[model samples]
Target: MEGELQRRVGRNLRAYRQERGLSQEAFADVLDVHRTYMGGLERGERNLTLRSLEKLAAQLELDPLELLTERRER
Candidate 1:
């Protein structure tokens, strides 16, 4: 379902944001999105468009696939 994908992407994005030491506000600015929209995205309440994803990935200096990838367990 869309909700599940949102959660996955949201979780991944949150992790990536933390790893890069970005505050939600700062990251949102970098992505050219509103702070509340960024909050919604982090909460899995917003659906992501491809362009939005591309901008986010670019801001992170990452490939789009990297943002979409799940981390492996040891």
Candidate 2:
């Protein structure tokens, strides 16, 4: 369901954000979204729109597929 997809995207986003050394608030500011909304996004509680997805991908300088990719366990 969407919940699982959200969680996956959230985890990916978290990893990317951390790799870039951005705090939640700083990331939110860069994305032009509210901090609380960003938190919900990182928690996989928000329903993401195409526009939002593109924005996040653009900010991360990654392809949208990268954001959607689920990390696999060894």
Candidate 3:
């Protein structure tokens, strides 16, 4: 369940970043994190802290809960 949630968050993050036309490296810079770390996050290989998740959502102008919720196709 934990892993599934992580991947869901990663997918949401990736979608948001892509929607803003930002690359992983650029997004990482905005988040003050390493590009490799961003890649890990997007790939769901790294676990994110609650604080970090909030920070990411804030940067994307999103509610933190949005990052956790799964997205469905319209």
Look at candidate 3 and tell me the lDDT of residue 18: 88
lDDT of 1 by residue, 1-74 (tens): 65887777788877877877999998788778899998899888988888888888887788987767776642
RMSD of candidate 1 to the true fold? 2.0
Question: Which stretch of 10 consecutive residues in model 2 shows the poorest summed lDDT?
Answer: 65-74
The candidate that wins on lDDT is: 3
TM-score against native, each model: 0.78, 0.85, 0.89
Determine which window of 10 residues in candidate 1 has minimal summed lDDT. 65-74
By TM-score, the candidates rank as 3, 2, 1
**lDDT (0-100) at residue 6 of candidate 3?**
89
| lDDT of candidate 2 over 17-64, digit per residue (tens) | 687799999988887889999889999999899888998899878899
Model 2 lDDT on a 0 to 1 scale? 0.85
Looking at model 1, the pairs that clash are none
How many steric clashes does model 2 contain? 0
Between candidates 1 and 3, which one is better according to TM-score?
3
CA RMSD of all predictions: 2.0, 2.0, 1.3
